[model samples]
Target: MENLKHKARKPLALSTIFLRYFMLLCGGMLLWLGLLIGTYLIATATGEILPANYVEKQIAAAKDILVSSPEIRPDQIPSLSDYALYTQEGQYVSGSLNREQAQKAWKAVASGSKGGIRGYYTVIQREQQQEVLLLSYSIVMNYRSEWLRTHLPNPELLGIILIVTGLLLQIALWSYLFGKKLAKKMKGLQSVIGKIQNQDLEFTVQSSGVHEIDTVLDSLDTMKNELKASLRQQWEEQQARREQISALAHDIKTPLTIIRGNAELLSETAQDEIQRDYNRYILTSSAQIERYARELIEISKTQEGLKLERVTIDTASLLEDIEELLRAAAVEKEIQVHMNAHNMPDFIAIDKDLFQRAILNVVMNAVEHTPIQGNITLTAEGKSDSVCFTVDDSGGGFTFADLREATKQFYMGDRSRSSGNHHGMGLYITQSIMLRHGGQLVLGNDEVLGGAKVTLEFPLS
Candidate 1:
């Protein structure tokens, strides 16, 4: 790509495209005019077109005959083409010329002009005659060229129409070719935009040959590379962070277990109420530390990856297993755990361990938030195409920020996991599990409980 960019031609201005179109149009018109004039000249040179003064010359050859035969009438003079007779004073006497032509011709004759509107006329007069003879013929061909079939009309006007039509066609063809090329390049540019928007950066960049379009494409190619590098770097950094957390969590569990074992031994020997209270605090704090370390490992595992081992199990059996875990988590806090399942399917296909773990995580999050001895409710219901499990806690409901962002990775609320700093992966992990199961996790406030409600929608297979 770097080499290609260097090889790319400098971009031409947009005005250049318009200029080319303008030149083609003007050039076509000039060509049309030249072709029309050239055709006429060729026809004239070959005598296919008559001379302008054809009738006038014929009239001159007949003048001596009319002068010698002085008794001939005004219309009987010899001529090869149309002519008109006029009184010496310029009043019409008539032959083939119409009133309009006779009037224009008389002016030409009187002024000694060789031509009238579209034809040439020559006047012949006798010394003793009462009328003047005007011979005239059209210079603009009133008939087709001699080489054309007699059935055809005059070539002059028809040639103009045909040439103009051809000019328009030529110009249209040029415009279409140019427009097609432009559209192809634009489509290439559009493809680049689409791929970048979708973050698909693994394809070759197609060159458009055009200097301007290729320049823009080259820049976009560079941008795509930069974005890919940034994304990969972020991914690598995230993987390292998760590995570090997982290692640290694993390291902590060994020492935590020793501390808990030592606390249990101290508890067995306590004799006074004050000494008993001190021993109870050590055991309880140790247990809490152990749970936090376990959570840290769970968080890293969730981010790294989890494989689903789906198995079919009865709904009642699944619920029974979850009940044991939930009550065990809440028993020490004196929190009341109410659970029920209604309208449930006979069985469901799911990864039993992961599914139960996700449910436990949600309950635990609620347990951490609820005041000691507070109430928590779990309900499961069968839908037309899904099984929904809802957990509602009678603790302060989700704040606005939590409602919007609680499921995002590592989004600890202002009050959430207050004792477990940097430990807010429970809901995120649950959501990830739900997604992997082709399901959804919905979070909202429970109006009845006046606390946070989490609904897990599991699509049934």
Candidate 2:
């Protein structure tokens, strides 16, 4: 916020830089036009206008002729044929004009020295000289004005064309330079944002050499550092928790094994049916407790993510293994467990052990929820970019509320639907495994099976 205030108080260099370039363009265009006009004038003066010494040469020739013919009168000078030659006093001794109007023409020509159609006059002194011949020439129209009128088109169209051309050139030049510069800087910033979005904080943020952009980059770098620290702390804490859970599960495993063994022995040796029933209950309960402990340890061990050792396994072989693993539990419950998969990949790259665990948990959850003689269908197939596994059981489908929270850790279902010692981490751990393998777990009601359906999708390598 303080930086924003400082920025507000400071001059905006971006606009200033653009405006400076624009001014330069305007000034440069004006100078170019001026130069073109100056060049045109010089060209016309040299190529179209009379020479500077034209009057001098004409006066010299006239004087020579007059000196050679002494009988020639001044009025009959015969030198001024189509031109008006005169003295400084405005007296004419030339042809093509009357004496009455010589003064007016002379005055007009003398007043317009640097403009109009008139040329300079020459004064020559003779050997027996009493008077001098003041000689000059004039054109029908002023060369400068004629040249401008001949070359220039409509004023309005000229202005419009010049303005449009300048704007187009400015746009082109600005795009080539300024636009490219901004895009390059912005693209670098975008890349940094993308990396941060991907949770990759291992890169450095480079300065853009622009003050405002550099400030933003500095803020992003600081945010990246803070996020990295926070994520590291979380990972460390989670690792510690996982290790503690694993140690606890290990410590309890031996006691649980001994208790289950003792109960089984009691059940076999007891004579009374009530006593045997009690022993059987203890045995089953101890076994369930041990299974829960093992599952807890396994889930905690891979809390962070699975370290997959991927291999190409045949789909048929994998399905067969799953069916065999769950066959005992399904038969005990009198549930019909069927495998229906076709149009699947021959081989898939997967961590066979982790994949098996995920499949087992999903199938076991279905088995626990399904009633006796219920149907459980497991399907696997290849999709466009992934392979999918679906487990659907013929039992009461999940409630809407359960559908939303069923995958959460330790979220057990209702008492009637939940299995003994089951705390609802099965789907959670399954989801974790699927995510670790770059897949997702989706839960819903199966239309065909009319029960809860769990779909696991894995991306193809």
Candidate 1 collision pairs: none
In model 1, which runs have C-alpha deviations exceeding 4 angstroms? 1-4, 8-11, 17-32, 49-140, 145-156, 180-211, 259-304, 415-422
lDDT of 1 by residue, 174-214 (tens): 78977886897689789989999998998667776566777
lDDT of each prediction vs. the true structure?
Answer: 0.77, 0.69
- Report the number of the highest-TM-score candidate: 1
Residue 327 Cα positional deviation in candidate 1, in Å, after optimal superposition: 2.9
Candidate 2, which segments miss by more than 4 Å at Cα? 1-12, 48-167, 184-188, 202-222, 263-360, 367-395, 399-420, 428-442, 447-450, 454-461
Clashes of each: 0, 0
* CA shift of 345, model 2, Å: 15
TM accuracy, model 1: 0.67
